[model samples]
Target chain A: MIPALGLIVGIALGIFLDPSVPVWLQPYLPIAVIAALDAVFGGIRAVLDGIFNDKVFVISFLSNVVVAALIVFLGDQLGVGSQLSTGVVVVLGIRIFSNVASIRRHLFHA
Target chain B: MSSTTPPPPPTDPTRQESGWSRLLEAAKPRANRKTAVATALALALGFAVATQVQATGKQGLESLRTTDLVRILDDQTSRNERLDLETRRLQATRDELVNGSSKDEAAVKAATERLNQLRILAGTVKATGPGITMTITGQPGQVTYPTLLDLVQELRDAGAEAIQIGTARVVAQSYIAEHDGALYVDNTKLTLPYTIKAVGDGDTLQAAMNFPGGIVETIRQQGAEATVTKAPSVLVDALQQPPTDRYARPVPSASPSAP
Candidate 1:
């Protein structure tokens, strides 16, 4: 419940602040968002299974974003940035679907 | 990265040997920090998501570098100016082609006789016909611009087709303006003893000039000796280039008319 409230407050702050993304970080924003989403979904699935760990969740979230951005940055240096970004998104998307499916099974029992 | 540390070996007796199964196993809840940490991460995720959406939304290109934006604007402005210049040049070329072809068609219809008449009017060729030559010897300022203008008008009225004063070929746009006691005939300065040569009916022109209270009589009243002499073949040899108009453009008219 508190996490949900924090999400709404964060959205409100973003809308009012109207923050502009820095040019240097613009290419990584979408990748980071997907990585964070994957972390959140995985954390929720862990919670449903009664195996949620605070330290593990926070560490995964941080590493997910940082690693995603790093991969894209390295790919840019190697002139394969777009392909790497696409690979990252696809992997994260599959993980999200799997975690969501687990959550659905826990909730609906189907 | 928080994953900077490697995972420990599975050594607990209660834990299973398989790695995937450990993710679903139940564990004891210890810290209140879990909810707080999740909430903060959720907030960060929400803010990033919102900002990413805004970037992709209507405010596109706002996130680009200033130099990139200026270069784009500069490229567009210069391209627009180039296109405008091209449009003007194309329009002028079109007008020239259309007008030039139509004029050529009309000129093709002008017979040899009409062509000769045009040549005479343009003063591009010599005119030889049954006409008269009149000589006027006037005082210093007696033959003013008005007197010369009246003489030319009278000759035109008497059906004098081509006329010449002194060495100047009088065309349709001819002018006589007085400048400091001398007469300027279309920018050419002429002093006394003006010889007017005209190509037309010699008898009629002589009769008109020698009429009672006419041009010759009027010139005599202005203290000038004017003589009218008829000739069978009078040659007006003064040649002048055709006048070029700068401001005036030919009015476009419909061509290919019905018979």
Candidate 2:
């Protein structure tokens, strides 16, 4: 979970400071890689003891990218790109909170 | 229990043969280790390839970021351009009002009255064509600059090719606005009941004046009287010399040039 969180945060920081980087890959890559790493490091712990559900990881990965892109495209069509970006940030903020909560629960064994 | 049941033959020859085979095969466990090592190498290679793909993916992300930045900049630039145009227009208007005549209050009132009396004299219906008349009325409260600009914008939008407020014709650089609680139309104080005249399509022009939620309605709501009429022709002289500051040079009189 710590490594997964780190990957996501790293990617986010990189994209924000250098906007030329493609944001579309942001949601899936970090989470997928982290989850894979977790599976390697802690084996059965992921299935029986880790805080994250594999399904949630996959769903968030799919939804975040698609929803964010769709919203930006829609905003462009409506002539309100800035407004759409603000919305994306809000959604991502919520996702970050949930992810942190999961991490905390897993690490604390709660 | 096995001793009692094992009398059931050798359970085929396999059990006896496997015991002999295992004793013979103990030295060849090296092959099994080699296979295990090969599998580990394959897994390691797969992991390396996955990491390489992630690096390529990061490059793609960088490209998208640049694109968003350009788009953001372009949007801001367009907004800036629009504001700049509006600022220049307002500046020109301010210059016209500051440098133009200040006696517009009396002239516009007189013109309004003249128009009203003329309307009464000419009756509601007349064969008007080329000439135009404008009416200005303000609310009891202080006149605002936005209101003044609104009137001017409406007139321009209405397609009035030629327009005059008080004694000054509307020009490319002219502006209308309010300052110090007074309404100003082109550098001149314009009290209530201002009259403006223009030359162009009378009916189309009149329709333009009373456009939805326009100055005409605003004026009427404020209890200010306004009227527009097209005349056969109304002649107007060129604008008077604009007022100048003490800092500027005095104008020479219209006289014959010295040889």
Find the candidate with the highest DockQ and give its number: 1
Instruction: Give the per-residue lDDT of model 2 (tens digit) for A30-67.
Output: 33333333322222122222222334433343444455
lDDT of 2 by residue, B178-242 (tens): 67777666677766656677666677677777777776777676667667776767544335343
lDDT of 1 at B187: 84
Q: What overall lDDT goes with each candidate model?
A: 0.81, 0.51
**DockQ of every predicted complex:** 0.38, 0.02
lDDT of 1 at A48: 60
Range of the 10 consecutive residues with the lowest summed lDDT in candidate 1 chain B: B1-10
Which CAPRI quality tier does the interface of model 1 achieve?
Answer: acceptable
Model 1 residue B190 distance off true place after TM-score fit, in angstroms: 42
- Residue-wise C-alpha lDDT for candidate 1, range A4-106, written one tens digit per residue: 6778888887778889888888879889999999888887776665556779889899989999999988887786777898999999998888878876665
* Model 1 CA deviation exceeding 4 Å by range: B1-31, B59-99, B102-159, B162-208, B211-259
Native-referenced DockQ of model 1: 0.38
RMSD of each: 16.2, 29.2
After superposition, candidate 2 runs with Cα above 4 Å error:
A1-110, B1-129, B138-143, B238-259
